[model samples]
Target: MSSSPRRPAVVRRAPGKLFVAGEYAVVDSGNPAILVAVDRYVTVTVSGSHTPGVVISSDLATHPVRRRWHEGRLTADGAQGGGRPRGGPVHVLSAVETVAGLLAERGLPVPELELSVVSTLHEDGRKFGLGSSGAVTVASVAAVAAYCGLELSRADVYRLALLATARIDPKGSGGDLAASTWGGWLLYSAPDRGFVLDLARERGIEAALRAPWPGFAVRPLPSPAGLSLQVGWTGNPASTASLVSDLHRRTWRGTASHRRFVATTTDVVHAVTGALESGDGPGLLHQIRRARLELARLDDEVGLGVFTDELRALCDAAEGAGGAAKPSGAGGGDCGIALLDAAAPQDISYVRQRWAAAGVLPLPVRVALEGIQQ
Candidate 1:
């Protein structure tokens, strides 16, 4: 326990992201993706604590866990307040540890704190595949770092969050982090994860941030002109990590087919980005349909199950309503997005009704104007 005086809570929230285009292909460094941050958020609160160690509570976890932060590491002390913590809060713990690493490097005190997270991204502890993990990690990093007296820019926060996330899942593209960091509609590409991690391991977080990340980039794009975005949940959650890892495990990973998939996906992403930038709604819609077909072809070739029955229904309904739709992420099953002409409210309404009839849930969320913020 600390004898230090108590401090007010520092609260930060990060909005969940939905991939408008580019899914499996985005995993490759520099492969671009379009994403938007939604109003749904995961909020993290960090405050001074009298506890002997760190106490973490989150809506997604069954029980809180206590951890000891020593020398930039967070070691599980024990379960707190109930049955044993199952894996505890991995993303939050990683964020805390990553921040501690930076603080230690700067010769600051690593104080014990109470960290709590509540998310609108999940229901009954089930994620809607709205980038809950990413939002939580982003929010936790900002909140914890702010509580520890560290001031960070959005880029700084994103760098730390990516470093933290890479520590847990190296294969991640960090597209979600980018969306959660910047908010609104943006075009994003990931750096080489392995390279970033290696740089951090050999040098430090600060060193890694200062170093040139070869393939990573983020460019904000205008929201589709005169087009409205719609989202539908398949109710079945997916393991993005699993779907992605499955791609790596397959013999298809480095094969010619994989190369073709990457090339085609990259092309579609660029074209969609162009349409978005030009405010060509029809062109954007055309590109989205192409993107969906591209994923469908990849699925057919590799058997990745990119399109679930519910997701297919979701997209079909959108198409039936004369809109464009596609699965959002790695897409074993999660969410799909639809784009309809804003002037045609009836079309949007029809799509939503069809989605509900197909057992897909329509999420009433707008694009968030800010990313991780107080």
Candidate 2:
């Protein structure tokens, strides 16, 4: 028999991402959306030892476990007080333990690992529509795979992350996870079958490949310096799940207004994609303005102001400042993205400062080409 002990586990890293389109539309109908991995990322390091322990530490949570426990509910009286224990990180740990167990169940060797996480995105509760949680979950799953020496596909990892996060927040489309896992522009729909892949090839990699990557196109634009953006916060945060539920509920009532709004969104998204491919800045801005108008129509039809008054005012200000604004995620209130043409960095900075004085936060970002990997 071979005598060498298993080598110590190494650090694994996975990139995070943001979705460019189809945020809310991907909920019911199978309409494709695009996403790109951002430079912001989360890295997980796994260390193995003969001793039995599992530890995870990151900004969101930290848990150390000596051994596995039954996944059943713990009685309040059983915790030294001996009934059921107060809930804490146990659920998260339980999820992690389940992953480890799945590997063992599959007849794969398992390691007692210490996992450390380092993240460069959203340390606080401010999600900013940048897909932070999806990135972290994807990173964690990657760590587990590395610990188990497994080569599971990105799709499997994305599915697992979705299941795990759903258990906690009970919301979200898996588009962010797919973007962070697979990288590049993702064409995703609601159901499984409607999804399509769009990836950017590494310089040499694309050149050597016999054919172009499927469903992907290259768009030429001036560098990000000339493309200024002003991200506006609405102060009132929204939940994707709740917004989706509301949309569904409204649609089910045979609400003519809701139907019309969704139909309009479909057309706008189609137009957005066309403008994106054609590199028509003015056309893209127009579509964004149209999308905002449709959203306003829906808000009026629903008789509720989904975007806060302050947010609307800020968007109007951006439009006055030579850009068009639209909601970044499911409305209610979260953030808005503004697109500007051939703007100097100072102009964008001044715009952000103005928002900051009013208590809205702006984040700077550019398109990215790659997704999660080793």
Candidate 3:
């Protein structure tokens, strides 16, 4: 009997995420964060490879990469020979290596493949900080799993993508991964880092990939009723890693102050969640204002400028229009979100005009109801 013909190309897409509330504090165990999966997406297409190795090309990359698995390692420029290419996309390599390792550990045959990635998560070479890396990893993993005839749930994709991202950078809280996996509004608490790391090392990658993630939870929540969300870009990109590193170096973690901060922020998150459930627009505004104050306090304590003048201006503009606003993620720059009292066209247009006057670019984004699509 002849072998079955190669499967056709697999295409997958995952949406980017926005941190509605709870940023730095979510790193603590069991702390809750509110995030939304945005409309922008990263799409990955995977097909059978004719060459001896995998070929990866992306719109974001200047060149394509050909890699092969040999002697328990991935070599660049195919299986035959060539030095590893430098300065390619880190997340792409991380995702491919991670899936390859997991397949090897499961005693499964590795197939030669080709991948093409396209994304709308960036504008004019500037990252929107919309969790592009996390989305790309999710899409890539989903595509590869399908290519290998492995069925993975959203949760499985999340766990695998989390591990893959951790291999690239262990500091991520996995909130982005969660949003990209499940989509929509979510209240997420990260899994225990120490436990996950130990598990990955003790058991083989297959076991780790298949293992149930402990202490992590992601639940969907309804969007606030009648509340309009808007995003404004500051035209300046902020480094989330740099902001996180600064917070860490300030000795902000594991201190009494940190505990107080978490408590205050958690209360805000709970208040927001409750408001969304109850459709309390005023309550939502109050909680967002409180959260912004709490973040400001944290910034003052750490001497890090989490809130820039532009962001503050945006917030002020929203408040002036009878809305509430705050910096979305790690702050310092990037984007800020405004929650309007109404979803009327006039209301949105007014806010947009004010945001423009404040020198912030209003981004056209909406809450994505769907997560990863294959």
Candidate with the greatest lDDT versus the true structure: 1
Q: Write the per-residue lDDT of candidate 3 for residues 1-374, one digit (tens) a residue.
A: 01234688899999999898898888755788999999999999988877766678988778887666665555663354455543466677677777777777767776777899999988877888888989999999899888888788888888888888887666778898899999999999888766786787788666776677676889999988878889999888998878887887787778898889899999999889999888888999999988888899998888789898889988988888888999998998888998986656677788889889878999999999989997
Tens digits of lDDT, candidate 2, 151-177: 766656655565555555433556667
| Error in Å for residue 153 of model 2 | 3.5
Please identify model 2 stretches exceeding 4 Å from their true place: 1-7, 49-53, 62-105, 123-126, 166-171, 192-226, 233-237, 246-254, 303-305, 343-347
Ranking by TM-score: 1, 3, 2
Candidate 1, residues 1-374: lDDT per residue as tens digits?
23467678999999999998888888989888889999999999999878866899887778877887544466665434433332678898899888888887787877779998999998887789999989999999999889888989999999999999999999999989999999999999999989999998899888987899979999898899989999999999999999999998999888998888889888988998889888899999999999999899999999989999999999999989888999999898889999988999989999899999999999999999789999
Task: Write down the TM-score of every candidate.
Answer: 0.96, 0.74, 0.93
Off by over 4 Å in 1: 1-3, 78-86
Error of 1 at 145 (Å): 0.8
lDDT at residue 140 of model 2 (Cα atoms): 73
What lDDT does model 3 reach? 0.84
Q: How many clashes show up in model 3?
A: 0
- TM match of model 2 to true structure: 0.74
Candidate 1 yields a Cα-based lDDT of 0.89
